[model samples]
Target: MKIIVVNDSVYPLTMGGSHRCVFEQCRELSALGHDVVCVTANEAAVARVQEPGGFYLSTYRRSENSLAKALGFITEPARIIGAILREKGGEPVACLSVQMFPSLLGLIWNVPKLPPFYYVYHGSYAREMWTQLWPRFKRSLKVSDLLGALYGAMMIPVERWVLGHGRFPVVVLSNYTRRQLIDDLGVKDDRIVVVPGGCDTQHFSHSAEGRARIRARFGVDDDTSMIISVRRLEERMGLDCLIEAYADLRQRSEKKVKLVIVGKGSQRDYLERFAYERGLSSNELAFAGFVPDAELPDFYSAADLFVMPSLAVEGFGLPVIEAMSCGVPVLATSGGGHSDLVAAIAPQCVVPQATARALADALVDIFSGRTKLPDRSACESYARQFSWGRYCSGNLAVIDRVLAQKSPPAQTRA
Candidate 1:
């Protein structure tokens, strides 16, 4: 099959779970002998390039200006559609995998002649924005927060229009997002399918040598427990809660422990300042910003546990699966996909709430041996169920089903 995967950015170039999902699926599709072309809006990309993963990449130039960047969400896809039309000559490909920003495509090109496509809905943009900015608006009542809230408020309708525009099948990473679509956007239940995110079990497997090397590099001895979190430093990501929890754990636990946070984001400076203010010293906490993709498995191997403290709009927690694939147990807050994964692996690994106190208590229980976690072998065994092959199988099934359907009436709304 010939597939055109449309997304905002490709993985490795733009690091995120959604990008990784799209990239991995493309790789799998190519491996399955399909001709795959990834269309992205990465400014660094050339006109057309082929990835080592055996798929072609067609990138549209994106502007670097602040205003252009903000409006690029809508404008960029228009350029993408133009590129697709110019390249394909208004002809339909075998399949279209719309990963992000489905608005312009649905609005501008909903002709019956277009090929069947399915939108991979990561999560509701309105819910994600409101989750991050609503707290700030409530606390400060700032104009920026007000504007952000309004923007988020407006996305509810935007999301609705995009999902309903073509009545296309929507594939989500979790049932949480499926529920959100049904309740929030009025998307029909039958149109949504839940396919969990995946981990590369082979690449992300445990290595005793890697564990030793990474721990030594981080200055954490085997006797000293190390809690690892690989998350972007954003408000909804709940890294602030993790830092506070780590601080609390230090005060009460007699065992030596350290926290190593990997990844970079806008909240890095604030998180560093917040850590210090919470009385965490350099010895107790380390920020390893922007580690390369290949080195992530080593970091996971070095950790005794992985924690995800997402406060809201966490469609699927990919890091938890990655860590588990590396034979590490996970502790995640109860809500969204991380908790779902942890609960399925072992119910004891999930924290009761997304609060600092709850995280601290969970840490205490695990360290004190009051809560028994899944063994390394078990963690690895369970992680195999979430491989990219498995994810792609479910996704491909949806694609096949969409392709078999008759073209629905063209619908549009603003």
Candidate 2:
């Protein structure tokens, strides 16, 4: 079936997990003999166009200037409608997969076309904004916290309107998000589908040779234990807590453990400052900011342990599964979807949220060889469960189901 997937971002842009997930799913879908056309904003369009694959691509200027950025917030639906009309040429558009911003546009435009649109709710915008705002303000703009909170408050209505009025089957990345849609948004159980983010098993597979090369490239000695965290340097990521915990672990551990932080964001400077304040140097913490996707597996395999100390609003921790695929044990916070995934794979490793002491203790346990690493075979097994092929198939099935059901409500000429 011909499918049009709508998201604000896609691959090569390297913005977030959702962007990469959508791009990978689309690539896999194209490989599975489906004609898939991806529509993204200007910022991500160039990347998708450059992707060496056979998928139809359309890019649009979603916004013009800074002023347009704020105003284009309301124009997203019209832009999507324009793109659909131009591309589909009146062919019965099968399914519309709506991400966060474009879901509203899909909801508004689908009213006339009545296509089976699936709302892929990654996480609640309100929760994400709340998690990001306070820490960012405290670290960067202390006075801006109130303004950030107000902005979040203003976004509530828009978020509520989209979730409430979309009236389409919801595709959530985790069971945790599925429950949130049901309990928080009052979405019915039958209307929700859980298809978590997937990994390219081959790309992230366990490789001893690759690990050795990556270690040598990073200047990490073979005898030294490596702890890697592949996440944005942001407040919600709990990097501050991770750094504090690592400092504590350093004081006690006999073996040398180096923390490798991958990815870059606004909070990098604050984290660097925090590390300095703790009397740690660049040697103890390596900031290999924003490693390319191709090189991610090396980083994963080079590490002895993968750490994710996210506090909350983590819809699904993609890196955790990637690390698992690389046969690296993971330790994550018992918050949001990370708790669910970690529980499923290795429950003993999930520690309390924001508890640096608990995180430090867990790290020390792994460092001291007191806690055994997860079974390599089991790790590989879990990784198989989240393969990109399975993810694409599941999503395609949902799209087919949605398309077969109904079109958008017909529009009455005014």
Candidate 3:
């Protein structure tokens, strides 16, 4: 099969769960004997490069001007994909659009010749923006966040039309996202396929040396329990709640515990200030900023426990799976996709709510031996099931089914 993947960004060049998903899917499709062409806006060393996984990567530079940005997003990707289609010259193909904007614009730009599109829906962008920014806008009364919320609010209708039109196939990362589409956007159940995002189980496995190195680097001793969280330092991530919860936990628990927050974002300064305000000492809370891709597994392995304190839009916490894959127990808020994975592995590990009280109580329970967390082997076993290979295979199966349904007539028309 010949597949053209259209998305705004690519992984490693630009990091995120969605970008990683796009890169992995394209790589997997190519690996499975399909000729794959990925057109994205991620600037690499070259405009067009062939990846080791047997896929072609075409990239475009991002513009500094606002109007240019919008125009480029619509035109640049379409132009690249148009060139690829012309080169193929009537080959049977399908489009795997990773984002709505690119898909919508690309379809408009090349309506006559564009192939059947399979939308890789990663959750509603408008809803995510509203969920993440509205609360901040209310609290801070910041003009930027207010405008952001409005923009996101406006996207709701646009998403509804694009997702539901023609009843196109929409691939979601979790059942949580699938429910959102049905309830919020009124997308039919059959059109949505729940393919839970995966982790690199092998790359993220337990490493004693790595564990010791990371722990020692952070000045965490063997006697002290290290609670780790790997996420973008943002308000929506609930890091503030985590800090408050850690303070509460520190007050009650007799054990020596430390919290290590990983990843960097605009919230770093705010989080640092909040940590101090919570009366947490430097020894008790350490911020490790911007961990590289190669070293992420080590950070996961260093944790005795992993926590996901997402306040909202907690769409499939990839860190939860990565931590579990490294033979570490995970506890998360009882909502979103990560909760599903955590609940399936150990029901007791899911925090009852996203509040500080709830999170703190759960931490206390685990430390005090009141709640039994899963063992290293158990976590490893459960995480192994959601490997990237399985995710890719599931995607390919969906593609096959969609293509079969769109049979000879559709192929001839294209």
Clashing pairs in 1: none
Clashes (backbone N, CA, C under 3 Å), per candidate, total 0, 5, 0
Candidate 2 residue-wise lDDT at 48: 30
TM-score of each: 0.89, 0.88, 0.90
Residue-level lDDT for 44 in candidate 2 = 32
After the best TM-score superposition of candidate 2, give how far the Cα of residue 103 lies from its true spot, in angstroms: 4.0
Error of 2 at 359 (Å): 1.2
lDDT of 3 by residue, 54-104 (tens): 788888887644334444666777776666666745665665554646455
Shift in Å, residue 59, candidate 1? 2.0
Rate residue 18 of model 3 by lDDT.
77
Off by over 4 Å in 3: 43-46, 63-75, 88-92, 100-102, 105-110, 132-147, 409-414
* Prediction RMSDs, each to the true structure: 4.9, 4.4, 3.4
lDDT of each: 0.82, 0.76, 0.80
